[model samples]
Structure formats: structure tokens, C-alpha cells
Target: MSNVTRYLCAAAYLDSGFRDKVLAELLFDQFRAIPPSYGGFDLMPVIYHCRRSRMMLVVRDALITGFFVIGCFMAPLSTFGWLWTLVPFALLTVDGIRRGPLIVRALIWFWACYSVFSLIFLAIMTALIPAAAYLFASGLPFSGLYGSGSTGSVLQQFLIPVVTLGIALVYRIAIYLTLVGSLKPGAPEPIIATTHPRLARRLDYIRRAQWGNVTMYANEDAFMGAGRIQRNWSIAVELDRVRESHKPSRRADPVDIDPVELHAFVRGRLIEMRDRVLRPNEGIQRLDIGDHVVTRGIFTVADGQRDRAAGAHPMIDRNGLPRFQATAEEIAAIARHPQGGVRYYQRVTINNAGQEIRDLDGNLVAPAEDQEALTSAFIYLAVEGRMLYTQFVVTVLPPAHDHYHVVDSLPTMTSGRVTWEALKVLKLQLLRDVLAAPVRVVRTAVESVRQSAMTPNPRDHIVYPYGARLSVRELGASESLQTHIQVLDVGKYIKMIEQRLTEAVLDFLEERKVETGAYRMQAAGITVSAGNGGTVNVPMAFGEHASATVNGLRPGT
Candidate 1:
């Protein structure tokens, strides 16, 4: 419940596309759940924000309509009678539309632009029409159509507003239908938790899962879409059973090793490193050991069938979830026939000391127990045949932008601040709203119709390469790490994980009775090169023409 999470919730309330993608698009009907990888943060707060905003809109719209009706009744008594009523009506209407769906908000903008141009044209015509009529009546014989007072008053008082409203209605319906018809079928329904109890439960489950478990993903990058890659390096070494001698001798057989056992041994050592930091408040905030599988991407049953026909692994279960973890038999088989699509990793997440976000009233916005860390580092280790592969990656998750955190700074009901704030907002927006009401009404109506007619399907129609790609946390994260301390922590954790991983692998190799002369040499070279911010090319044999290149910090920098 950091400010990043709060900002994301506010963003979901404002942007329908983002809300639908996180709450609906990533869900699987069979499991009735969102994939762990895609849903990396809490979602209940987001749902709450959306529902609250919708309710507020309803109240605001009702107030605006009431005032508008009163204004219409008072129009005959005074020349500017409707002008007083327009203030509150327009103000409320503008606020309501701003909190509405993104599509409607965008349409309102276009309509406002068009209305401005139309009003200017009508104003010029209103002035010219009366002058032209006077000149014609004085110069020519006919005086029938030369009454300037009545005509000018009629045009100014009635025609301008009437024409603007008329154009808004026509334009709204046209754009609404075009956008609605173009929408993809089977889109996710609006997340109305009260109206849809089942969706609310699903959201709760996703929130709990994010907190209680480590989500998995099958992708090309060691840690894809996590955040910026702060640091990364890999090391590979050839293995042999016989000890090296100064004189030439017969070649010995290669050592037989279980890749699974080797992976477990290294993983256990990394876990021990995590265990050494017993005080959770002192060192790493989170440490998880899990199999990090690599695949082209998550695919559906249809994709699996297509791949099966092409004589390749389908990579999915009958339930349509991706086969992220391999079975013991599958692992053993892959170890015997080594490939690139499977890897095991140890993830270490470190918490950096940063200032917490506070509201305008100076209250902490995030909960005490649920403040998520912004930095995470990953260690990938795999033993394939005679070559051992190890990679270390660091990613930083920055806080969301300032604007999206407006929800935290809004006034509350205590001390009558809400009412006072509302009055102030009305005063500021009254004039602008007077001119924007017609366009707002047209846009709101169109949006309402679209929502009612096109009810979204709960079940998503997922296709290959169309499933969820980016994570919600990553999507809302800032462009880079926020502070100098965060950057320092990134380097600290990378080096820590790297030291533990290297020691674990070297020990495991020696315990297997394998020659470590070449491995030691390569390790020393890699350490020196990395310390100096350079690259080390280590030639490793996997299948044929396979080589591994270890880079320092990043490939180029």
C-alpha cells in the first residue's frame, strides 16, 4: 500500500482501458484467477476507487440536472435569469464528465473545440445581419425584413445556445456509434463490485495472491518487464571428470551430473544466504526460490494444437494455463537433452529507505504493513550437461507520477472540508462550465448508451501473443529509480547475490569431483572484468556453435 499502489488505483479509476486490462483481461475462467505474473500488486483498492468515483458522478449529475431544470423555469422572468442557474449546473456537469470514462472525456474535448468555433461564427453573423438589414432598408424600397432589434435579440438569446446543443447531439451520436462498432467483441465488463459479486471475489483473490505468493512468468529475458536492468552478468564453464596434468595423457570421460540436483544445491545455498539475515527489518525484505521457466510466450489450447501439429512442445495444460514449471520427468529429460526454454532462479528483494507519501492534511496514505519495496534483484542458475549457466539481474520499481496521486490529497468529510472544497471548485469552474454544459450532456448520454448496449463478456477470448505482457506495477512505475540511496541499494544487492551464487556454484562443482582449474580461471577473469566495468567472453559448448558472453553492468555500459 505504498503511494505507488495508491496512484495506480487512482489511475485505474480514471482510465477504463487500464482497469479492464488488469481486472478482466488477465483472468482465466478455468481457474477463475488472474495470472500471478501479470497481477503483481493489490487490486481491491483500485476496484474501490472506481466504484467510489462512479457513485460521486451520479450524485453530481443529479445536482446539475436539478439546477438546469430550475433555470429553464426562471428564464421568462428576467433577461439573465438563466445565467445565475447556469453557474452551479455547468460547474457540476464539468466535474462529473471529467471523472467519467476516458472515451467520453476525449469526445467532450473534441466537442468543446467545435462548439467554440461555432459560437464565434454565430457572434459575427449576429452583428453583421442587423447592420446589413439596416443598410438595405434605408437604401432600397422594401422595409419588411429590416427590423434589426427583434431579429438580433432572437438570434442572440435563442439561436446561439440552441444551435450549439443541436450540433453536440449530432456529433456525439456519430462518434459514439463509430467507436462502439469498432470495439473488439468479448471485452471485459466494467468492474462494478456491488452489482457483480463474483468479480469482487475474484479481485480479492488476486490481491491475496499478490501478497502471499511469488508469481511466475515464461519469457525470453531473464527478468522481462520487471523494470530497468540496473546490473546483469553471466558465467559458463566446461566440466570434465579427470584432473589436468602437465604431461599429455588420455582424455577422461565427462562427469555425469543431475541438473535438477545441481539447481537445488545452488538454490539451497542462496536460501541460506537469505536465512543469515534473520532480522527482516535489517536486510532483505523478501527472498523467494522458484523455477524461472523460459518460453516464447504464454499460448492457448489452439496455439498448443498448432505447435503439436508442427512436432513441438504445446507448453500448456488442459486448463489453458501456461506450463511454467516442468515435471520431474520433464526436467530430467531436458537435462539429458539440454535446451534454452527452462531456467531456475532465486529472487531477492531489498527495501530502500525513502520518504512515505502523505496527504495534504499530513496523513500517511499507505498502510503500515503493506508498504512494498521498490527494488528487486534476480539470480538465475541452471546446469545443462557439462556447462553451468548463471545470470544476475537487478530491477528497480519506481513510484508513480505526482498527478495520479491526487486521490491521496483530496479533501475528506471531516471538519466540513469537503463542502468548503466543493464550493471553491464551483466558484472556479462556474464560467467555463456555462459554455461546456451542452457538449458535456451529449457526451455523457452517448457514453451511457454505449455502456448499456455493449455489455462485456466476463470470459476473455485469448489468442497467441495477445495475452497480458506488461505488469501493472511496471506500467505505473516512474522512468528510473527515485533516489541515490535506491541506486546504491541496487548495486549492493546485485553484488551480494552475485557473491553468494558464485561461491555456491564453485563449491557444488568441487563436490562433484570435477576439475575446477578452468572454472576458477574463468571466475577470476569475470570478477576482474566486472569490477572494471568490462566484458568477458567465455566459450561454452552446449549443442553445436553455442557460446556464452558475460557482460559487466550491462552489455555496453
Candidate 2:
């Protein structure tokens, strides 16, 4: 089977209609290159002309209509021929009215109104002239309204229609000129004079690695809505283009890029991101450290001294005899021992400072402090092909910022069940701690005393004690306190994090060696700041490494 047919069959699995169309086009060469035409005339040029002159569509309609009127009088064919001529004019007029610019449409409407008024005025004048002539003077030059072959009479007869048509023609010319000035196509894309195969190859590798798909926003609605800014990240792919007028998907020729320069760009961007996009405390909030342990293992290099000491030595026996009888398996086992013969390494907690944190009570706090303490964290990186992937596990713990107000409602309870409804009533009574405290306290006390057999004076009851303390055992059972914590603005932190990462990526691309063409490149990423559930995509580009360079050419050369 041909490549086109195979492609069609593969697509058939997804869509039958598309497959059929492709197959048909392949089978019939005529379908592959079908020209657009109507009634033996090519319509493509006409279509292009219309598109190119969209603003002056009104002129086309007016001209067509004027020609139709003239043709209807001049045609020698049947009445039907004259009517048929009106069809295209009618369609053009409707299109021009609907699609033309405001100014053009306005001019068309003015011409139409003037034409109608002229026709009406001509009819009125023709009738009034004869009546006036008969009443005033019977044998004047215009005695019968417009007499016998005189220039004055001829001018009087056709003045309105001629003047109206003249004005319409003048307006059409003005519309044409306006369209030419406004709708010219933009300049063509510039050709790259030089090629950097290494740079191009590296770029392709980065694209395949999906470095651009970084998460940057945690809550877009809250972030964008609060700021009153709306943005689209997909268009970011077009940002690297030097020319703003080009379409978003247009590709430019590859340009030369230097390895040393690209490295500097990447390094600079990493630093910028560290300082600006990622907050001083944002990543700290995401640290993986727990109470006194680093949940994620700490990674460090092994010491050369330890590696040497851990290596296995040849076996020696007494009397200077070498034990050479050991089996190959035993020797191999000794050499690859899980820990004995392995390189030396150590594990330690991931902390910036050795100082311990303390609470207000002077008690030792957890290794992972509150949001404020999480201002910095470690960045883990992995290299695959030409791409670098960064990952970090962040730990966030909500702080206690709420006040507790315990209320004793034991006095309100009697020998009845403590249902949810009864609890709600007692809650309201406790909440009324400010106004009319004494009155409500007294009333409730008396009511309670009457219901029960206890002989306690109602006047002695106290709801809120200022300088004295009064204990009521009945109300003591309803003690409760409300605690609230301050809400952390995670949106702001996410925004900052995204900005820092983007800046880092840009800095990576902006160095001298890389020779970035990203005059307006916009970096975008998802803000995966929500627990282990967050996701983000970030597009990135960095120049070839110096080690990959050969002879005189750069790494990507």
C-alpha cells in the first residue's frame, strides 16, 4: 500500500469520514488539486479581491446596483433577463451592508436615502409645475413643464437623478482609497543567514522532554480574578518570534547559538528564579521535613578516604601464606558486599541553620516549623538528554491562630436529654456575654430554681464576674471554647513562585552565547502548590554544554 493509503487506514481507526476523504483524494488526482471555479470562470481571484477590499464592499454593491438599473433599460432581451441581472446585485448589496465597515456602510445608507428623496421630489415637482404654469402664465419657455428640445428643459428634466448618481460615484472612489491604505498584507518572514545544527538539535531535545510544561498557578481563578487580569498560556509558544506581526504558529529559520553563552544564561536564570520567582519562604513551606526527621532522604557525596577504607583487601594467613583457595563466588560476594566494600556516604537532615526552634513556652519545636520558618528548601535536579528536570517535595503545616471562648452551660441543663437543639440554645445564651448579662442571668436562675427543688437565690446568680467569682454547678457542664486560625494567602505565594521559576528559565535563555531571539517570549507554568496533587508544565531552553563541543565548533554545531 502507498504511504497515503497507509496513513488513511491508520486514521480510519479514529475517524471514517476523514479516512474516506483522504482515500478518495489519493485515488483521484483531480480531487487532489481541484481548482475553485463557477460557470467556467475562475472564482479564486474574485474571492481574493473581495477579501482584499472588505472595507470597500459598499462600493461593489453600489456599482452593481447602478449597472443593473442601466442594464434593465438598455437590454433588448425578455423581462426575465433584466430581473436576473438584479439577483447578484441584491446579494452583493446585502453582503456589503452586513460586512462593510461602519463608515462605509454609513456612506452607502446616505446615498440610498438621497436617491429615494430625489425620485420623490421629481414626481412632486412634475405635477406642481404644470398646475403653476396653467394658473400664472400659459405660454412660458417651460409652458408644458419641460418643452421641446431646449437645453434648459433637458437640464430641468434629469437634474435630480444625475446629481444623485454623481454623488454616489464620488463616495465609491473615497471608500476604495480607504481600503487600500488599511488592508495591505504584512511583511514576509526574515531568512536566517547562518545555521547552528547543535543548537537546533538541543532545542528539539528540550521540546521532546516537555520542559515547557511546568506548573505555575495553584488557584488561577483566585489569582487572576483578584488581580483582574486574564491571560492565555498557549500563545506563549509564539513569544520567541522577533516580529510581532507574524502569526503565532509561524516558524523562523534557526540561528547560531554558543555553548558557553547558553550555560551562562541558564546559570543566571537559576539565580534570578531563586531570588525573585520563588519566595524566600515559599519553598521552605514545601520542605519535606517532619517533626524531627527529613521525610525525603538527604543526598550527599561519599568521601574518598571512606571509599578506600571500605574496599576489600586480599586474604592473608599466618606464616606469610596467601589464602588463594577462596571460591570465585566468595570473592565476588566480598567485593560487592551491600555496605562493606561500597563507597562511603553519610545521611543528614536538610536544614539551613543548626539553631533549634522554640515555641512561646520555650519548648523545643518540630523540625518543620510553621509557614514562616519554611523560607528555603533544597532543589533536586535530574538530567535526561538535553533537558534538566527539577523536583522538590514541600511540606506545609497550618498554624494555630484562633481564640478559644469556653462557656459553662451546666446551669441550663435539668433532668432531660441533651439533644442538639438544647445545646444550640445554651450556645446562644453563652454568646450573649456582653449586653444584659445580669438581667438574663437572674431570669434564668429564677426559672431554673422554680423548676428544680434547689433553694438558690436568683439575685445572687452571676453570668459574667468582674471582680468576684460565683460558681454554679448546674451551668458548669456546658463549658466550650472556639479556636480560629489565620488564613494563609497561598495564591500570592503561588504567583511569586511561578514568577521566580519563569524568570529563572528566561535568564537561562538570555545569556550572550545563546543569542536568544525571544524578544517577547513569555514563560508560563502551572503552580503545583497543592499538596502532592499539584501539577505544572514549564517550557525551557538552554544552550549546548561546552564538553559536547568538538574541534572549533560548539556542542550543537
Clashes of each: 0, 38
Itemize residue pairs with steric clashes in candidate 1: none
Per-residue lDDT value at 178 in model 2: 28
Give me the candidate number with maximum lDDT. 1
The Cα RMSD of model 1 versus the native structure comes to 11.9
- What lDDT does the true structure give each of the candidates? 0.51, 0.29
In the range 436-528, model 1's lDDT, one tens digit per residue, is: 554555676886687567544322434344223546666666676656655555656667777777787778877766666656655555544
Candidate 2 TM-score over all chains jointly: 0.19
Give me the runs in candidate 2 sitting further than 4 Å from their true place: 1-307, 312-378, 381-383, 397-490, 512-557
Candidate 2 at residue 285, lDDT?
24
